[model samples]
Target: MIAKKILNDTFLIRNAKVEDAIQMEYVQSRCYPTLHESEILDRNHFANHIKVFPEGQIVVEKDGIIVASASSFRCDFPEHDSTFLEETDNLWITNVQIPNGDWMYGIDMGVLPEYRGLGLSKEMYKARNEVCAALGLKGQIIAGMTIGYGKVKDQMTIEEYCKKVMNNEIIDPTITPQRSAGFRWIRPLYNYINDPESGFGSILMYKPVDENYYL
Candidate 1:
């Protein structure tokens, strides 16, 4: 949470403050046009962490402006959880799925284009894992974007676009580098690429917060 000491002007990693909402939204807008323009998770939604922790959450800042961020929490899969959280007064073992353990899901990760060549994205991811490790989070999961066909700027139709990108031919160019960074796809039963209402090709990428997942 308090990570400024480990990073500096070259890059500053720290927890989010409530007032950083506007700036966080600015960075989010520049990096994720479709998501931001659609107002899927606006600053107000991101700011809701204040309801739990008035300070908001964790943030990855560079030169005083936030480039990326991740919250310290995990989603509860209630239907899959057949637990006794309703009856148990304390958690004896967290492996049972009913709010069993804490994990930091990578809520959003992005960087402005100009700052990219500096390897900021990779560094941000590294920091994310570090934060997860510091808090003993179980793992990190990210909903990655899918951009198909030659190049998004040059692609004419969404069909052609999907074919090329989905086929692993021409990626977003940016997201393609994730392979080397130790991220792996968490396969889903359905055609992840064909689902549009849910946004095409969005898959869960997982990275173990600790070596435990490997064990």
Candidate 2:
């Protein structure tokens, strides 16, 4: 377990266990209220993820309460765009993960509303990066939610909004944080998930393990 104390509270970040499934599900539901029920991870899915790739699932707890979690798998970077369900194989992950894949595919990451500003997610990201380094994977890739887009979606195109976010003209609750965490935008994906708030759009982003990783 990775333990730290912040603001007089203790936080623990560690690889998830089967027993943590229920709390993980709870955290997921709380973090993604805008997502459709089918798109959110459930207790059974969390259990399956840990069973399939024990080291790829992680969770954060504060004062003994689960507050955040992330799920990931190994895969080769794809050449074509795909929906979130297709990329994650309907969240089963077993069929899509490549044991010897070149990249770490970040399936999802979430921090409860009350824990959002505490940098718990950042610690989780660090833990995942350590996993990538240990496995010799090239880096991490993900389809990030354009969460703030939902508020102004009818006023502009998804592409235009993404561009604005990219250029710092706008700050997306999701994409902006991802950029701060070192992800580079590749493009926008449509019909990525059932998130009306994001206008059903997601951003394809990548973070190389190192500057020389591609070389």
Candidate 3:
């Protein structure tokens, strides 16, 4: 696919290249400081993603510098599984990518602080959706962090917090945007990532491919 610029050529969104790994790593570090070092994917992981499912990995660039990125890979899970414990035990892309898996699992996404409000995050999700449709995948899934819940956790439980966010009673810096883009919460995942503020939990979300989606 041809790389396209958005917002009057101020930003460009395109498939990630192996050489872009270093910048992707930088963006991740800047975006998620509270996350443990072990939880963050390194350059090697990003390279592996390009080698495995290049189409599922995307990056956004501003004036030729990488400023945002999203990573995903295909993985299969039991349709009846409620918790996704076994399905997500190893959230790393290299460890979990399944060649024939029917669903695209979003592993990481981030945008630099300075690039916020420029629609970069939404473009990354749209890229993922396009990849899903291209591969004929059933849907896209994300173990999304409740990044805004830390401030309210003292007042309510995690489940309650998610419900409020879903009902528009609250806004999550992370989940709210995904919900607006058509994803819906499926359940809460425990130990989903090594995040301490959110108690290592994430809101599992999914968005089905539209029946008429085309390449």
Q: What is the C-alpha local distance difference test score of each model? A: 0.51, 0.86, 0.79
lDDT of 3 by residue, 163-213 (tens): 787788998888888888878777777666677677567888888788353
What is the Cα root-mean-square deviation between model 2 and the actual structure?
A: 1.8
TM-score of each: 0.65, 0.94, 0.89
Off by over 4 Å in 2: 1-9
Candidate 3 Cα errors over 4 Å, as ranges: 78-92, 211-215
Please identify model 1 stretches exceeding 4 Å from their true place.
Answer: 5-9, 36-39, 50-56, 76-102, 148-174, 188-199, 211-215
Write the residue-wise lDDT of candidate 2 on 46-141 in tens digits.
999998888788988876788899999889988898888899889889899898998889989989998888787777777888788888888888
| lDDT preference between candidates 1 and 3, better one | 3
User: What does candidate 1's lDDT look like per residue over 30-119, in tens digits?
Assistant: 765544233334567456553343221566676677766644334332222121222111111123222334544444566666766666
The clash count for each model shown is 2, 0, 0
Residue pairs with backbone overlap in model 3: none
Candidate achieving higher lDDT, 2 or 3: 2
